[model samples]
Target: MKEPAHHIILDAISQSASDIHFHPTPNEVEIHFRINGQRHLYKKIALTKYKVILAYFKYTGKLDIGESRLPQQGSLSFEENKLSYSLRISTLPANSLESLAIRILPQKDIQSLHELFLFPNQFKQVRKCLKNKSGIILLTGPTGSGKTTTLYAILKSFMEDNNYQTITLEDPVEKSFAQAVQVQINPESGLTYDEGLKAALRHDPDIIMVGEIRDQSTAEFVFRAAYTGHLVLSTLHAKDTFGTILRLLDMGIKKLELEQSLLAVASLELLPLQLRKFKNQRAAIIELLEGEILSEAINKQLSPLTAIDFQKLRRKAFAYGYISEENCF
Candidate 1:
C-alpha cells in the first residue's frame, strides 16, 4: 500500500507534473495529473483502496484523518535524487465524500527568468523591476498561470545579486527558502495577511513577498506597507495587465497611492511551446505595464495601442517558431 503511493508520487515527479488530483466518488477515486496547464487522467482506484492512500497522505501531511466533513490544508516534504520537494495537500468535502489535491513544488529547481519567459525582452523587464529598492511589483494572472513559479524564480534571481533581507507571507508556506524568512498565515490562530504584513514590517525586511492579495483589505494593507520603503512583491488574480490595474483601483487603491508606490504589473499567460526541445512544458508570455505606460494607467489613461500585450506576444511566439498555431490563437 505504501509502495503504490510512493510510486505514484515518483511517477508524477518524473513527468514534471504540477498537481495530482484525486476525485473521490461513491465507488472509486479518479486520479489526474496536471502537466503544464492541462490535466491528464492517470488511473482510477477502488474506493477502499483510495481510502488507504488518502489516509497515508493525511498522516504524512499531518492533517486530521478522521474528519472529512470540512476542508483542510497541510504540507509534507520529500527528498528524491538529491532534489527536495514540498507537496501541498488540500482536501475538500464533496457530497458525502472528500476529494484531495496535491500541489508539487520543487524547492531548489527554480527556473531562471530566461528559461521561464518566452521572450527575452519580457525577461529583461522583470529583472529591471526587481532592482527597485522600494515600491510594489504585482504579478497578475488566472489560476495555474505560472504566477507562483515566476514569483519564486524572480525572488531567487534577485536574492543572488542583492543581499536584501527577504521575507514571505504565504497562507501555507509552500517551500522553504534558505535565504529568506518564510511565514505561514493561519487566520484561525490570528495570523492573517493584514496581520502578517504588520509583523513583517517590524522585521526591517528590505524585500517583502506576499503570497497573494486575496481580498480588498489585504490589498489595501499591502499598498500601505509598500509606502514604508520596502520593496514588495505579490500576486493577484486578474484577466490582464490592464484588468489588474482596474482591480487594484476597485480594491480601494487611490490613484495617488498608485502613482506613489506602484512599480509595475505583469500579467502572465503560459504557452506550451511547439519546439521539440521544450516538449511537454510551457513558458510564459507576459503583458508588462511599466514606465510611462504604467503612470498613464494609474490615471486610467490606458491606450489601445499595440503595446506588448498577450495577443502581440502570442503572434511573436508564432512568428519566432516558439509556439504552435493552435497556441497562437
Candidate 2:
C-alpha cells in the first residue's frame, strides 16, 4: 500500500506538480495533479484499494485515522535526490468517504525577488520598503500568488547583509531558515498568533514576520509590533492595493494607526509569462502603494499617482510581448 503511495508522490514531483487531489466515488477513486496552475487527471484506483492508500497517507501524515466527521490537517517532510519537500495534508468528510488534498512545497523551486517580479521597478520599490527601520509592510494577494515566497526572499536578502535578529510566527513554519528564528502556531498547545506575538517580542527581534493578519486581535497585535520600532512583514487577502486599506479598516484598525504604522502595501497577481528562452513560466505583477500614495489611499483621497496599478502593469507586459492581449484582461 505504502509503495504505491510513494510511487505516486515521486511521479508527481517528477512532473513538477504542485498539488495532488484524491476524490473517492462510489465505485472508484479519482486522482488529479496540479501543475503550473492547471489540474489534470493522473490515475484512478479501485474503491477497495483506495482504502489502503488513504490509510497509509493518514498514518504517515500523522492525522487522526479514526476521525472522519470533521476536517483535519497535517504535514510531513520528505527528502529525495538530496532535495527537501514538504507535504501538507488536508482531509474533509463527504457523503460516505473522505476527500484528501495534498499541497507540495518544494524548497528548490523558491525564487529570489529579482526572479519573481516581472518588472525591475517593482523590485526596486519593494527593496526600498525593506530598507525602512520600522513600519508594517503588507503583501496582499489570494492564495498561491507567491506572497510567502516573496517574504522569504526579502528575509534571505537582508540576512546576507546584516545580522538582524529576525523572527517569524507562522501557522506551520513553511521553510526552515538557519539564520532566523521560526515559530509554528499550535492552538492545541495554547500557542496562537497573539500568544506567539507576545513570545516573539520577548526575543528582542529587530524584524518580525507575522504569517497573516486574519482577525482583529492579530491585526491589532501586528500594528502594536510596528509601532514599537520593529519592522513587520505580513500578508492579507484582498483583491487589490486599494482593497487592502479597506480590509485593514474593516478589521477594526484605526485610520490614525494605519497612517503611522504602514510603510507600504503590495498587492500581487501571478501571470504566465511567454518568454522565448523559458516558456510557460510565471511572474508576479504588483500594485504597490507606498509613502504619500499610501497615506492618500488610506484617507480616501484619490490622485493620479494611484494609476500605477495592475491594469497599467498588465498593459506594460502586453506591450513588451511578455504576455498576450487576452491575458491583459
Candidate 3:
C-alpha cells in the first residue's frame, strides 16, 4: 500500500540482496540488506513509515495483522521486470518493538549446477550421488549457504531428464515445479514433515525431498523412508561434513541405520569468486562425502578422512584460482 515498500523491494532486487531485515526501536527502524553473505545497513525509516510498511507486508503475506506478541511466518509474491519473486516474511516479538525479516527468493531457477559448484568434478559427484534410487543424500550448511539452491537445481535436472515421481515437503513450498508434487508443512492442517512423509510413501514416489530435518521426529521419518527403498533428499544445518554425522547421531539415528539408509552428504560453502565473469557474485564449494569415505564416517572411523573438510575446500578453491588469497584461509 505504501510507495516506500515498493521502492525497497525494487532496490533490494537491483542489489541482489538475499534478505531484508527491519529492526524497529522506540525511535526509528533500521533497514538492512543481506548481500553476498553479509548484512549492510541501508537506511533508517521513521517509526511511522516503518509500521505502515510492516503492516503492508504482513497483510499481503497473509499473516495475522492483529497478532504480534507471538511469531508469524508467511509468503507473498512480488512481480517486477517480467520476473516473479517469493518473499518469505517472518515476525518476531522484541522488547522494544516487533522485528521483521524477509527472505527474497526467485520463483524460477537462476543458476545451473555448473555455476553452483566451483569445481567441475564436484558437480559430477553431486550427480553421482543422485544416481542411486534409494538412501538419503543430505546437504548440510549454515544460513546464507547455497543448500536450497543446489538442491533445487539438481531436482529440476532430474525432473526434466527422467520420468521419475518426485515429491517435496517444504515448509512454505519455496518454488513451483511442474511435474513434482510439492507439499507445504502446516501443523494446523494436521500436515507436518513427519505426516507428509507418511503420505508421500503411499504415492510410490521415485524421489522424496524433505525440505529440512528440523527435529528427531522428522529425521527418524526421513531415515525410515529411505530405508524403505526410495531415494530421499534433504538439507540439515551443521558446522561441517563430520558435524553432520554428529548432528544426526544426536538426533538418535543409529550407526547401522546410517550405514544402510544414508547415501551421501555434501556440505556447501559459498565463496566470493575472483573471476571476471562472476563479478559481484559468489559460488559454492562442497565438502563432499561418498562411498568408502562415507562408510568410514558412519562407522566412526574418521581418522583417514582428515584431509576432507572446509579447509580442504577453501584450499582447493584458492589453489584453482576460483577465489582470491584474501578470501581463503
Candidate 4:
C-alpha cells in the first residue's frame, strides 16, 4: 500500500472508527468513517491513493482482484506492538471498479466487570447470571452497540474461574479468548448455526456462545442447548430486552420452550460520552428482564416497562458509573 493509504488506516483506528469507506470520484476520493452509529468524513484523498488502498485491502484479505464486480468479503489481521486488530473487508462495484468498506476491530485486554466502571452491585448482577449452571442469557442491542464487548467480558470472567468448558460459534469469529474453543461459521460449507450447535453439544461444552439467533432453526438450537444443561450466551438485534422474547417467538420458538430455558435478557444501548463532562469513555445503559416479572410479562405478552418505568430504570442504572443523567430520561 502507498504511504498515504497506510496512514489513513492507522488514523482511522486511532479515531475509534468502526468501519472505513473509500469512494472514487473524478478528482477526489471520498473517505467515510463510521463512528458510533453515524458516518462522518475523515478527509478526501487523491484518486490515485484510493486505488492503492483498494488494492491493499484486496491483497491483505486474499480476495480475487478480478472479482470486485460482485460483492466479495474477506478479513485481515494486523498486529502492532501488543495491539491486534481483525479488519473485516467487503468490496463492491461503484460505477466502474470496486468500492471498499473495512471494519475496524480493536483488541483490548479483557477488562474486569468492576473496571468497566460498573457499580459493584451491577458487577454482581452480571456475574450472578454467568454463574448459572444451565440457562440462556440473551444480550440485545443494535449493531455496533458493544454487545460483543460485553459477551467477551463475561467470557473473560468465566475463563479466570476455570470452572467450565466454553465454546463459541461466531459467524466471523470476531475476537479470540484464551480459554474458549471458538468456531467460525461458513455458509458455503453448509455448516450453519444449527449444525454448529449440534456439534458443540457432542463436545460437552458447559457454556456455548452463538453469535446471533438469526432464524428459527438457530433459535431452537440455542434453546435446546440451554435445556440440555449448557449455559448459553448470545446476542440479538432487538429494541429492548423484552423484545428479545418476541423475536424468539417470531422465530417459531414456542412460549413454553422459552419460559423453561430462558434465564435472563440483558439489553444495552451505547450513548455518546461527549454529551457529558467525560468525553473519553462511553456508557452502556442496560435493562435486565428476568425471574417472575419477566416470566409473567412474556407469558402474558405484556410489555412491563412503560416510559415512566424506563426513566426509573435508567436512574437506577446510573448508580453503576459513567452513565450520565442526560442519557437516561
**Best prediction by TM-score:** 3
Tens-digit lDDT track of model 1 for 99-176: 999989888866777889877878888998988899999999998998988998888898888878899988777667
RMSD of each: 2.0, 2.0, 1.6, 3.1
Q: With candidate 3 superimposed using the best TM-score fit, by how many Å does residue 305's alpha carbon deviate from the native?
A: 3.1
Please provide TM-scores, in order, for all candidate models, with all chains considered together.
0.92, 0.93, 0.95, 0.86
lDDT of each: 0.88, 0.87, 0.87, 0.79
**lDDT of model number 1:** 0.88
As a whole number from 0 to 100, the lDDT of residue 81 in candidate 1 is: 98
Model 4 per-residue lDDT tens digits across residues 279-319: 65665657778787678767988777431234565666565
- Which candidate order results from sorting by lDDT in descending order? 1, 3, 2, 4
Candidate 3 residue 76 Cα shift, in angstroms, is 0.5
Candidate 2 lDDT score at position 232: 97
lDDT of 2 at 74: 92
Which residue pairs collide in model 1, if any?
Answer: none
Can you write out model 3's per-residue Cα lDDT over 1-329, one digit (the tens) per residue? 56899999999989999999999878899999999998999999899888899899999999999998999999999999889999999999987578999999988754567768777888998888878989999999998898888888888778767999999999878888777899988989899777888898899899999888889988998898887799999999987788899889889999999998888899999998888888888988888887888888878646344437777778888998889998788
* Displacement of the residue 206 alpha carbon in candidate 4, Å: 0.9
Prediction 4 TM-score vs. true: 0.86
Q: Can you give the lDDT of residue 313 in candidate 2?
A: 86
